[model samples]
Target: MHRDTGRDVVVPEGLLRIEDCLDATGGIALPPGVTLISLIERNIANVGDTVAYRYLDFSGPTGGHAVEMTWNALGVRMRAIGAHVQRHAARGDRVAVLAPQGLEYVAGFFAAVKAGMIAVPLFAPELPGHAERLDVALRDARPAAVLTTSAARQAVDDFLAAMSTADRPAVIVIDDIPDTAAHDFDPVNIDVDDVSHLQYTGGATRAPVGVEITHRAVGTNLLQMILSIDLLDRNTHGVSWLPLYHDMGLSMIGFPAVYGGHSTLMSPTAFVRRPSRWIEALSAGSRTGRVVTAAPNFAYEWTAARGVPADGSGIDLRNVVMIIGSEPVSIDAIRSFNAAFAPFNLPRTAFKPSYGLAEATLFVSTIAPDAEAGVVHLDRQGLTDGRATPVPADHPQAVAHVSCGHVARSQWCVIVDENGDELQDGGVGEIWLQGDNIGRGYWGRPEETETTFHGRLGRTSTSGSHAAGAEADRTWLRTGDLGFYLDGELYVTGRIADQVCVDGRCHYPQDIEATVADASPIVRRGYVAAFTVDGDARVVVVAERAAGTARVDRAAAIEAIKAAVMRHHTIAVADVRVVPAGAIPRTTSGKLARRACRADYLRGTFG
Candidate 1:
């Protein structure tokens, strides 16, 4: 089944049966001696003068002034940077990047890759502890040097000043670096299996874990993405507002564009302060050809609520394939976006919900291009009871969730029981995957590497019991995601670590949020967070009450929500906080940062 909106096309059936969708090769192909850096070199050699990256400076509101870089120019700049780095850092040394998204950021990243240095990209500081997080990352990574914009130099300086000389890594201001002069250096000889990058997990202080991505792994994943999604052929232009620190922003969008030799437009803050700018960028790309872009679920929701400006002229979105990922997939957000932009030629299927992680080098299962948006309606009661029982969409017990589609080409995924046994179709379990695309392991943490990567057990078949023999021979990456397969399509339910047990039943935070939103129009649907406080599970609903109405009486609202939840699912709500709109914290891609929010709440940062 598919949906058509004038110029937009969606193929729902294309993603519904992912296992059956591929040929016998299973999408895994052994590339003949290729690495990620090699791919970039090839692109530069072929399209050396072709424009690669274009950026809009956020300082200008109108966004007419921008900077552009061609492949040849980028290669030259990268070589100079690599030469400078080779003088200071050796192979396998860590080089950190702490700049906003732009040409310089990409150049720094690629230069690190060429120098055979592990690239560590950090988020631009937003709060007081931002520097502390960077400090922790610096200490953990033990980088040879740090790269930052001139604007961020002071912060880096202050951070280094507080540290002992022996503890601090050398800091280099990106803008301060002069052009290469007289020094000619060869790029480091990098092994395909060597570590390419270290993507830091959000929890910096909590045993800083960085997913160790390899050049070969990332390169194969990019090839799979290009082949499976047909990104090389279909997408003539790419635009992204996702932050560079994120896997989706870096590998999925950035690497693919470079690998495919396509022109890419980027903005660091455009999607954050004003999401409509992303839509505007897409419309701008439409004038040339179809533009493929990506964001999390909330981005779509935000753009839908705040309508894109018409300007007395129509902006067609039919050619846009807005990949919704980097967080939990929200079906309501997808439906709302489609309805909101129907008149703008936004096809229902254009919202391609995908699933991936940094350990997988970003690209994993993606809804096939032009595939009808895939959905799974399951018994909410059964889902909470640790069983996945399909329910009719209209059934009172039904909960609608979208599928992340199928595994990307060259990768294999399985739903496994707690004992490491592969579950049958429609059975919920932790998502485990194995492929050449899988990252090596966590950087500098052998114990964590063993726990998350090497020690994971593999399944012999889709519906087989856990084989103890194969566990030692094969390496599987535990995704920490709780999901199930229906008709070969993967439907993510919740994070394994995010599940809270309430009244002997496991309640997913997402399920709680959806139910609370349904109970009260005042409750912000996706902003709700359910977690445990002390010994008891608590549901905290943060919402924006209607304007001009009586201020939300917290005591009454809490009781009302408690009663509503009890009546519907026999679950009790511990608290409900109604705040001004936009109080909830979200990731750059627009997914709720639940852990960050919980920390903020504990620190009294949120009212």
Candidate 2:
């Protein structure tokens, strides 16, 4: 073992080997013989041991310190947890990990996979604003066991207390499990097609749905992400603070491990409180020469505004490639981040605008590491008319959208009309994906799965080298996202459900929300939700008044929002309400909860 403390166990003979499934270079191909945990052992033993995973502990007495876990140690923990969990949960049963962000979360996830169980990556009950989501996910998955830490046991118990006895799962205190239990770890025969985890979607439009992600899908998507970002370098290091349960965060947890790279992590709370901690981690991780990480649009804006060191002191981002994606890629946020970090040697080409969703196992496409973010200025009315027409940046109706990059590696992307007929280059329509990384479908919803995951092209769709020679029977993922292809890049507009239509013209809510925020400082930036109420014939805008705003100004703020939307979008608002900060809801991924607000609005819950 690379960092041996003299504690070692014999290699289990039952362990499946995946070496045969891969090419000689060990770069591509994934067969069902072995799981990710199996490869972790072989990779560490074949190469020398190194720091496989690291956690930046901000809640510690020493202010902040990094806890390192070597690859060998991580393997031991996996086996220890795996063996203990198997004793509680039968093979193929759902096992939810309810631990906080740390190595405990990481080990618990891999352990479930090694035990031939379907892992439902979830959050601790203490994570505020997500309690309802946790309950819904557990009730939906109906996991046989829940793995949590000793510190979180009481809260976990309280959370489960609300459920009936039969619905409550067996709780495993992962930290209390003895390391010696790893000796009893028995690797099960798992197929590539077997369900590996349930990636619960963020309910921006509807209730949270668990996507049945298979082992094959995870492996294929991981490979696609690594190759797309040129992250195959053995020295790659990943730094992130995203919640591990989310799709992108779950993928980042192992992005470094698939190769010989190391992962540095911290709590999302820490990153939010002091964004500089993320920048510091990036600088520290840059010692490896090739560092990769990811974050949503909000994180970039926050890090730029409050994270960057004033003098550009110690951070060096010369070798960092941070993938930025969140529904609609914010072109302004990208520019702000690069400009703020430029003094620290952050290259203009370092940030990659990308597109992905849980349905596709979290990755669809991302710009190349070598290319700058692809953005285009288009006419606002043209985009609303289902056509992407370019206009001058100074044009009054000009709107900007960043490219989520071309379809990655082997995936196929096609923009099709409502009838499933392929659209031309400039046609803005629903974006569909055909790839190995796509999840099986929504868990336990066969009809919904058939509608979402089973789509056939009405006609042949061809887009530059991608989606060529499409078979008539290839199943496509109807990624409810709306976008179009321009010069080989995918420009995601907005969700199909999130679109507001009045007088036969479709408009994305984000554009109206942006104008609302700009209309007056009274409106909180990035806290506006625009939707249509009263049967899609009337436009409604609900905005969050900035913190410390006077109650007397609500009328003027509402008037400003209405006037701005009418001027910019040429739509009359049927109702405008300026609510207090945080009265508006937001998804866990930091997206405005427009649908939730609409529900409350319909219930007359907002005063």
Candidate 3:
């Protein structure tokens, strides 16, 4: 069975049967290599002089300098850095990248692969204002060397100084290494199953869970994204302000580089400082053709609400495909972006709602380019009762969820109940995935890996068990997210770990957080975390204050929030805390850390 994804690009045949699709298409594929290093070598030989990357430095001494690199130039630096790495590390060793976002980071990452070492991409310590997460990751990976540029040498030095000599790795300064050194180092023999990189789960604060991504998994995912998104031409360029350590950023850059596509890079801090920079880059790229870019939901809302020009000068977004992924897909965020920027000629189809995680090597399901996002309103009470009952727009309990489009060609998605029985359509349960894109699992944690990566569907007959041949796709990935399907499209509700159960009815924390955020003017949007305390069926919400407001009347705001939840879904709020702006903890990808917030509440940290 096939479904149309708005574009003439039809979802591949037998989309529901992922295992069979893989059996059919695995032998004949192009664009991605058997190994990432081989892909780099292929690009160097084919498009050596084409502009591969462009880094925009808004705060450089030259005042907005553009540092460009050709594929040939990058290859030379890659080999030189690889030669330097070979001096201290052997093949299959781990190498950590801690450089600031720029060309140096790119060179160092490719160099690790060229030297046949597993690359661990992490953020520079000073950029995020702490090294706690880096400390955790350093202890986990225990790399042979650390890669950084002169710009971040001091910060890296300071961080490594705290560690014992035996625990510390040699720090390699990328800029100091002369490109004139030997660029003809022998290529290490690499297999498709070799580990390419270790993508740490969250940045700098939480205990890092290194996801061991293999060369075959990454290469297969790139091909999946390219074919599913219909990236036929090499002329299409990518503009990204996301950090290099993030899976989204790394995979986005990886796809273009492997297929000889050009990309424009900028610091994430630069984008936050001036969101208009992202707009300008997109507008410029659109002139040549459709520009490709991606970010989380918050970025779209932030750029649209704060970045779009009042007079609309230097803004034309006609040919831009900005994919929204990472966190839970929000309908209000999409509407807010379209309403703010649509007046400037941005099409309604520009916002592509997407869903993915680190376990799947980043790119998962995304809306097609030609269609507007599909949205449906559901009754809140019905949702808690395990039913996706549609409600009228004016209904008191109505909630809207945007579809994450169809899964990639060879990927299968199943919504299952607690006992591992597959659910019928409209039954919300855990999301299970089966595809080549799934990673090898967490590094050095086989027990956790087996439990998460190796899951089996209920083999017994049930009301919702897949009819036949579904047993072939038995080995599935437990996504840990809760969602359902309606009319063949996937809709993610929230995380299983974050689902709040009150009065024996299941409720998503995001739903409660959204209600509180919209309940009062004082509560900050996109910064609310909803959780529960021990011995309580009532919900607790921790929210930040909006900027430029006078001291809020906390009591009045609390009453309004409590009243709103009661009116909307007949729920009670056990506690409501409104702290200073930016008080809530967030992952490096800008998602609210609900578990951390709960721990802080228990410890009275916000008090």
- For each candidate in the order shown, give its overall lDDT on alpha carbons: 0.69, 0.84, 0.79
Candidate 3 lDDT by residue in tens digits, 8-93: 21222211111322445353232223567666655665677888889998876555778999887888898789888888788888
Give the best candidate by lDDT.
2
User: Candidate 3 at residue 334, lDDT?
Assistant: 83
Better of 1 and 3 by lDDT: 3
Residue 237 displacement in candidate 2 (angstroms): 0.8
Using TM-score as the measure, the top candidate is 2
What are the RMSDs of all candidates, in order?
7.7, 3.4, 6.6
Q: Write the per-residue lDDT of candidate 2 for residues 1-607, one digit (tens) a residue.
A: 2322333422333222334435665434675344455456555565436777899999875689889888777778888999988888998899999999999999899889878899999999999887988899999999999999999999999999999998889999989998999888876766778888999999999999999998778878888887788776767788899999999888887675566567889999899989999998898878657788898898999898889897837778888888998889998899899889889988888888889999999988998768998789999989988999988889999999998886776678889999988898878999888877899999989999999999887765554434684444778999999999887778999999999899888899999989998998788787888998878989988887786667546678778778988999999999988887788888887778889889888888777
Clash pairs of candidate 1? 11-370, 11-371, 11-372, 12-371, 12-372, 27-410, 28-410, 48-72
Which stretches of model 1 miss by more than 4 angstroms? 1-27, 30-33, 126-129, 204-208, 256-260, 455-472, 536-550, 579-589, 600-607
Which segments of candidate 2 are over 4 A away from where they belong? 1-28, 31-34, 461-466, 469-471, 547-552
Better candidate by TM-score, 1 or 2: 2
Model 3 misplacement above 4 A: 1-33, 203-206, 310-312, 460-474, 535-538
Model 3 residue 607 lDDT score: 96
Candidate 1 lDDT, tens digit per residue, 1-607? 3332221212222211223324575554444435566555555655667777878666665554568888767767777777777777888899988776677788888777777789898754543334655667777888887777777777667766777888677776656655562135464566778888898765511334688888778767766665556655434577887777777778634553334445455555556576677777787877777777877777788788885666555677877777787446888788888887777777766777888877788877877776978777888888876677888899988888788887776577877888877787778888887787888888888887887886455354544433322224677888888888787788888787667677667777776666666765566656676666555456554554544536556566667777867776777766666766667665444556566666666677656
